[model samples]
Each structure stands twice: as structure tokens, then as C-alpha cells.
Target: MPRPHGFSYEIRNDTSVHITHQGRAAATLRAGRAAAFLAEVENGDAQLVMARWTGSYKFGNERTARNHPRNRR
Candidate 1:
């Protein structure tokens, strides 16, 4: 699968995390979630981490599902 891109995050002064994808707001994490996300992001791919946090990460089955016999239009 291709690596996820276009994901960025900002830490607000109030300790909230604002996550964006392709320049649009995708998720806002506050308090406990924000703390956890910061910890994980520091240890892994930031883009992938953001994508996963926003529930937007691909699971590697998209192409197969798209071309499956039953999916043909």
C-alpha cells in the first residue's frame, strides 16, 4: 500500500490537537486523546498516525474490492 500523505497536526494553546488532511480539518483531539496522540505520533509516522486517528487509513484491500466480480457496474 502507498504511504499516507497530506496529513498535518497542530497543537493549540489549550492543549487540543487539530488534525488536518489535504488542508481540511479532519479531527480535533482534546485532553486525554490529545495526550495519547502526541505520545504515539512522536514514535511513529505522523501522517499514518493522523490518518488512523481520523479513521481514514486504508486497509490494503481497496483495489481488490474495487475490481471484485460483484462490484462491476
Candidate 2:
């Protein structure tokens, strides 16, 4: 749950868009001003991509943490 590596994403401010390494949102893209910026992207394309990427990372991270040697029960 500690996302120590953090996520990666490319932001195209000129186009008001971004893309993750997996072709989704590279970071959390939190709600608020940042969300507002993502809203400007075409078809919310960048937003959708980021959402998927973040979700996937979080899920995978949680699964791995749950099975980690230190976390084992």
C-alpha cells in the first residue's frame, strides 16, 4: 500500500492530456484541480487511461503485499 516506487505518466499540458506506461493514467490523478485539468483531454481519454493504470497498480500492489513474506500470517 506504500507505493514506494510511485507511478509514472506523461502529461501533455499543451493538449491537456497524459498517458501511462501501460497506456493508462500513470499516477493517482487525484480529484480537484488536477482532475479539472484531465477533464480537458479529448474524450477524457487520458483520464480513463490513468484511472485504469492506477487501479491496476493498486490492486496488484495490494495482492503482492498481502502475500509478502513479512505480511504472511
Candidate 3:
């Protein structure tokens, strides 16, 4: 199945996790690793960031993250 927009951590029946970003699959990690990553995120070992865009995709802007709006909060 296609991925969902934004961030999501989905656990599969086999105990593997599917990580998605911007409607795309970014990574697939084992359940153990996934848990560790989540722990890191919670402990501040990782920084989670997101960006959004406007102009209805008509701006023809690049998909590069450097141009996306950073999360200010």
C-alpha cells in the first residue's frame, strides 16, 4: 500500500515498522530498532522536524527540503 502524508510509524504483523514521509516510504525497521528510535526521539537524541508548503503546488518550487518551511514551534 502507498504511504500516508506526513509522519507515521506503522507496525506490521511481522513486528516490522514502516516509516513514511510526505506520502512516501522512507524506511522499514525491525520492531526492536523502531522502539529504540522512538526512545531516542523521546530522549532528545533525535530531532523530529516537519515542513509544509502552499501555493497549491503551482509555485513549481523545488522539492528540496532547503526550500520548505521549517517548523517554528
Candidate 4:
């Protein structure tokens, strides 16, 4: 799959992480979750990490599912 793009985050008063996708609000991580996100994001691909944190990452199943018998037109 193509690398995830258009994902960005902002830290609010050192208390939360606000994630956005293509300029729209996606999710907000608070307290412990925000702390964990900060740690992981600093060590990995930020875009991919944000996508995952927002539950938007692909699991490589779209193509297979689209071609399955039940989905065929």
C-alpha cells in the first residue's frame, strides 16, 4: 500500500495529542495515551504512526476482499 499521507498532530498544553487527516480533525489522545503516542511517534514514521493511532491503517485485505466471490458484481 502507498505510504500514509496528510496526517499531522498537535500537542495541546502537554496534555493531549490532536491528530488530523487532510486538515480535518480525526482523533484526540489524552493523558497516558498521549504520552505513549509521543514516545512511539518520535521513533517511527509519523504519518504511518498517526494513521495507526487513529485506526485508519490498512491491513492489506482490501484487494482480496474486493475480488472475493461475495463482492463480485
The most accurate candidate by lDDT is 1
Runs of candidate 4 with Cα error greater than 4 angstroms are none
TM-score of each: 0.89, 0.27, 0.44, 0.83
lDDT of 1 by residue, 13-42 (tens): 999999999999999999999999999999
For model 2, the run of ten residues with the poorest summed lDDT: 1-10
Which has the better TM-score: candidate 1, or candidate 4? 1
Q: Give a tens-digit lDDT track for model 2, residues 1-73.
A: 3332333455454533344554444444444645565555445554344555455434446777888899998
**What TM-score does model 4 achieve against the real structure?**
0.83
For residue 4, model 1's alpha carbon misses the true position, in angstroms, by: 0.7
Quote the lDDT for 43 in model 1.
100
State residue 15's C-alpha deviation in candidate 1, in Å: 1.0
Q: Each candidate: how many clashes?
A: 0, 3, 0, 0
Return the candidate ranking by TM-score, descending. 1, 4, 3, 2
Name the TM-score of candidate 1.
Answer: 0.89
lDDT of 3 by residue, 1-73 (tens): 2212356556788877666666676677776776766565566522141111111112233445445668232
The numbered model that scores best in TM-score is 1
lDDT of each: 0.95, 0.49, 0.49, 0.93
